[model samples]
Target: MTAALSPSESELRETLAQVLPAVRADLEDLVRIPSVYADPARAADVQRSAEAVARLLREAGFAQVDVVSEGGAPAVIAHHPAPPGAPTVLLYAHHDVQPTGDVTAWTSPPFEPTERGERLYARGAADDKAGIAAHLAAFRAHGGAPPVGVTVFVEGEEESGSPSLTRLLHTYRDRLAADAIVIADSANWDVGVPALTVSLRGLADCVVEVRTLGHAVHSGLWGGVAPDALTTLCRLLATLHHPDGSVAVAGLPQGEAADLDYPEERVRAESSLLDGVQQLGTGSVVSRLWNGPAIAVIGIDAPTVAASSNTLVPVARAKVSLRVPPGTDAHAALAALTEHLRSHVGWGAQVTVTGGETGQPCAIDASGPAYDAARSSFRDAWDGTEPVDMGMGGSIPFIAEFVDAFPDAAVLVTGVEDPDTRAHGVDEGLHLAEFERVCLAETLLLARLARG
Candidate 1:
C-alpha cells in the first residue's frame, strides 16, 4: 500500500486531466503498429512499440528505463524509487497484440486506427496498448516521479502464449519485485462498468488427427463401407458433453462461482450468440464458463462449404482448445482430454493426439489493503459506474508467475477494455471514453496509494 499524505481531489484532477489528450494520442500511435509474435516481417514494428513504451516510462519520471530482451520480445522495465517507507508497486501490461487475420471484415483498416463514434477501432487499442498507456497516465498525472516506489513491466508476446515471461521472471526477478502488482490486461465487466478480474480460466491446446483409410475414397465407390475420418472425429468430440450440454468428463468437477455474478442474459448479449441457435452449455453462466471445463473444436481440416469435394476424407485433423477451471493443472487436464479422445475410437479408427503448451489460470487475493484503495480509486475514476464482478475465459500465464513469486502480493487486474470490446477477434476496437475513465481510475489508485 502507498503511504499517507493527503492531496485534494481538485489537485489530482488538475494533474491528470491536463495531459490526457497526449496520452490518448500516444495510444493511437501504439495501435498503428502490429506486434504479432513470430512474424519476422513485423518484428521491427514490435520493436518500435517496445521503444515507444520505454520513452513513455522515461517521460513518466523513471530515472531508469530500459528494454530487457528475453528471447521472443523485449520486456520494458522502468524503476522509480519512492520517498523512504513507501512501498513498491509493479504495474503490468502487454505491448504486443494478436495478428489481424483478415482486414476486409473490419469497418476501418486494422492498423489504421479510426475515430468517429467515441471509439478507436484498431487491433491493440482496447487489448493492451490502451492498458499500457493507462499506467503512464497514472504516474505522469499524480507525480511524474511517483510517491511510491514503482516498477513497470511492459511485456511483449502476451498475445502469443507468453512463453518468454517465465524466462524474464527467472532472469530478472529482483527488479520485478513489488508489494502489489496492478495488471491492466483484463476488460471491464461491461461498458462504463469497471471490474477487476479476480480469476481467469486456464488453457490447454492440442491437435487431434483421425486416420481411417489410406486415401479420399470416392463416395460413389465406397459409400457404405469406407470409414470416414471426419465422422469419427466428430463422434469423439460429441462425447465431451452430455445431452444437457454439460461436460461429461469423468474426473473434471463442475460447479458455479459462489457469487453467480454473470447473468445468462448478459452473457448471451455480450457473446452475440445467434438468436435461433440455442445455448449449448448448461449450468449457470459462471459455472459453465469459469469453473467447469470446456472443449471447443476451433479449426478443422476438411472440405469447405464452397469448394466441396464429394469424397471420403482419408485423414481429418482438428485444432482443439480445452479450457480448464481456475487452479486446474494444465498438464493433468491435457492428459485427461487426450485419453478421452483416444479411448473413444469408432470403427477401429486410429487417433493421434499431439499436445501444445498450456497456460495456467490465476486467482488473485483481492481482500487486502491494495484492494481497499483500488475500490475507492475505481469509484473516483469512472463517475460512480458501480463496478461489478466478473471472470475471464482466457488465461495470462505470467499472472501465475507473479503470484508464485510474491505469494503475499495483492494482484489486481483491471483495464479499459469492456465485455463487448472483442479483443482477439475481427473488427476489434476500444471505447475512447472508457479509455480515459480507466486512466482516471488508475490515477486515483496511484494517488491513493501514494497518500496511504
Candidate 2:
C-alpha cells in the first residue's frame, strides 16, 4: 500500500493563517467561561466549559464526541477513525483553569480575553485553553479531514491536580488509544524558539506538624527554657535546605538536565528575583531548575501577626512542596523528606508528617519516527529553527499515566507558552504569532505522520 502525500509547508502555513482569526475568536469565547474547576463554587462553569469543548470538537468534524467522567469533573473526548494503514494521534489539553487570584491585580478582567500588543491575556489563555484552540486550528487547517486518525481529549480538571484522572483514564482507556499523543500543556524555549518537553520534575507534598508544649503558655514565664511550636516548625523547615540553599535531604535522587544555555539574567528577569538575592542550589541554572530536588515551605498554619499574643502556641503545621528530578521515584522522595523532618527537629519536639500527594516524573526518550516528524514539523513552522529538547520543573503527573496506559505510543509534550505567558499568574497570556506557528506545526505533523 502507498502512503499519503505530505502537505507542503507553505500550504500548511497558508491554511493555518486563514483559519487563525476564527480560532482566536473561539479561544476568546472559551477563555470567558471562567471554568475554574478547582473552585467548588465554579462547578457549573466547569460543566458549561465541558459542553462548549464538546461542541467545538463536533464542529471540528469529530463525528463521535462525548462528555464523559468517572466521578470527577467533566472531560470531553472526541474521535476520528483512522484510514487504512494510517496511525492514530491523540491530542490532549485541559479546559479548566486556576482561579483568578486577586482579580483586581489583573490589568484586565481574568475571564475577559484582552489583546495587548501581540498577546492575548486571560486566566487560561495560554495554559490550556490555547491548547484546545491549537487542536481546533490544526483540524480546520486540514479542512476537518486529516489524513490520519485523531482523538481529542480536553480534560476539565487538570488545574485541580487531576484527582480523578486515573479513574477517567481507566474508564476510557480504549477510546484514547493512539500511535502518538501530543500533550499541549507544557512550554516552549522562548517566544520565537520552539521546544519539545523531554522531561518533567515529579511532585511530592506533605504537611508537617510540630508540637512543643501541650497547651498555650505565657512566653515570659518560660521564654528561654521552653520552645514554641511555631518556632520549632520554622527551624525544622530550615533544616530541609543548607546555607547555600540546596536541598539537604539525605537520599532523594537527582537527574541531569539538558545542557541548555539559560542565562542567570533571564532567570532573574523571569522569576522577578529581588536585588542581591543569590539563586539557590549548586549546579547549572537549568540543572537546578529541572534536574535536582527542591523543597520549599509553601504554607504555615500559625497565628497571624495581627492576632498574635505573648503566648507559646501548642502546635504548628506547615505544608511543604517537593520537586524531584525526572526518573526519581516520587514516593521515595516523599519518604526521604518525611524521614528528614522527623529526625532533624531537635529538642525532642513531637514531629508528625502526613504525606499529601505524589506524582511520578517523566523522561522521554525523544528519538523515534513520530518524534522525527514532529521535529520536522516544528522546524518548518519556525522557519528552519530547530526545536529544543527542554525539561519542565513543573509536574504534570498525568503524562506518566498516559505513558503507562499506552506503552507502545510515542508521547510528545508540546506547548504554546513562551517565557512571558505568565501561566497561572495574574497576566496569563498567549503570544498570537507563536500560537500561529504552533497550529501550523500540528497541522504539518498530521500530514507527515500520515505520509509515513
lDDT of 2 by residue, 152-194 (tens): 9999999988999999888899999899999999999998789
Q: Spell out the clash pairs found in candidate 2.
A: none
lDDT of 1 by residue, 1-452 (tens): 22222466557677778888888888888888888765778888889889989988887789899998878797799988877988888999999998887788888898888886878888988888888889888888877866788889999888877887888888888898888799999888777678888888888889989999988879888978888898888888888888877776666666467465666678678879777767767667776776778888899997777986889888889988888888688888888888988898689998999998787877766786788888877776666556656777777777877788878778888887877788888878888878877887787787677666
Model 1 scores worst on lDDT over the 10 consecutive residues at 1-10
List runs of model 1 lying over 4 Å from the truth: 1-7, 258-265, 305-310
Give TM per candidate.
Answer: 0.94, 0.98
